[model samples]
Structure formats: structure tokens, C-alpha cells
Target: MDDRTAEYLVYLDATLTEIAGLARRGRDAYDRDIAVSRACQYNLIRLTADLERLGSDWLAHHPDIPWRLIKGMRNRIAHDYLTIDDDIIWAVVEHHATQLHHALENEIATAKTTLHTDEQTP
Candidate 1:
């Protein structure tokens, strides 16, 4: 893998960890507190951008993920910031973020293994 890809994997992992912590307060807390909700949404926007920067090759390798939707979400959150639906954002936080986190963790592990193997080659 390229150095940029490795760097992004590290960033993605860290961002997801932060998001998970942010959402640990659960839906009620998230919904009740505008700060928590906005924090989660902001990180998601960053996450989506990071995924896009990971390049087409990285994305194509992980076809199982909803790349377009992820990108679209960033746009929605940014463009429709005023009228953004709390329920949908909460759902994305509770559901999709966890899924994406796990998927990224797996991809990072696989990439690390491959990198190690390459280094070991003659």
C-alpha cells in the first residue's frame, strides 16, 4: 500500500474511535444535547472526506461499503445544516458509524499484514 493510504487508515481509525466515544452517551443524550449531535456530525463529515481522499483504488478494493452515500451525507450535512434531521443523523451515528469503524479496522489490519509481508520478501 502507498504511504498516503497507510496514513489515512491511521486517521480513519482514530476518527472512528473518537466518534464511538462521542456517541457512547446514546441516542437520548445525543438528541437532547445539540453539542453532542453536532460533534458527531462534524466528525462524520471529516470521515467521509478522509474516505474520499483514500483514492479510487482504495475505495474500489472495498466495494462492499457505501462510498457514494457516505460522500452524499457530507454534502447533505453541510448544505442542509439548518434543516438536518436529528433522527437520521442519530441513526447514522448509532448504526453506520459502527459498521464503517469495523470495516476500516479490518482493512487496516489487512493492509498492515500485507505491508509486513512485503517487507519480509527478498
Candidate 2:
């Protein structure tokens, strides 16, 4: 991984943290409160953009991740904000988001170790 990919991974991880914080209020609260929903959506959008910045090459290595669906959700959240359904978004927050966050954390650690090994190689 190059410097930009590493940086973007950090950003994604941080954004995931923020999303997690925003989502802790539970689905009922999120569905009832537009502010909570907006915060989660905003972080999720940032997360998708950061992943996109990592580009197709980086994404290819993690084929198991639902990259396309994530990007599609980002598009829907961005382009169709007015019709954004709280239930679906909350479902993503409660289920998919945690899985993605953990996966990204593991990937970031692996990438850092790989980079460290690469640097040590003469």
C-alpha cells in the first residue's frame, strides 16, 4: 500500500469510530431523531469516500467486503437524502457497520505490518 492508501485507511477507521458513536443511541432513537440519523449518514458517506480513495486496486485485495453495496449506499445517501429510510440505515448501522469496522481495523494492522516489513527490507 502507498502513503495515500494508508492515510485513507486511518481516515476510514476514524470515521467508523464516529459512526459508531452516533449509532449508539439505538434504532428507535435514530428513527425518531433526524440529527442522529444525519450524523450516522454523514460518517457513512465519509467512510465510503475514503474507501473509494483507496481505489480499485486496494479494494480488489478485499473481495469479500461488500464494496459495491457500500458505495451504492453512499450514493443513495448522498443523492437521495430526502427519501433516506431510517430503518434501512439503522439496519446498516446495527449490523453491517460493525463488521466493516472490524475488517478495516484488521486490514489496517496488516497493511502497517507489511509496510514496516517492506521498509526493513534492504
lDDT by residue (tens digit), candidate 1, 1-122: 67567768877877788888887889888878989988989998999977888889888989988988888888989897888888888778888888888877877876667666767989
Clashes of each: 0, 0
Candidate 2: 10-residue stretch with minimal lDDT: 110-119
- Local accuracy by lDDT, each model: 0.83, 0.81
| Candidate 1 overall lDDT versus native | 0.83
Residue pairs with colliding backbones in model 2 are: none
Clashes of 1: 0
Please name the candidate that would achieve the greatest lDDT relative to the true structure: 1
Q: Stretches of candidate 1 above 4 Å error? A: 110-122
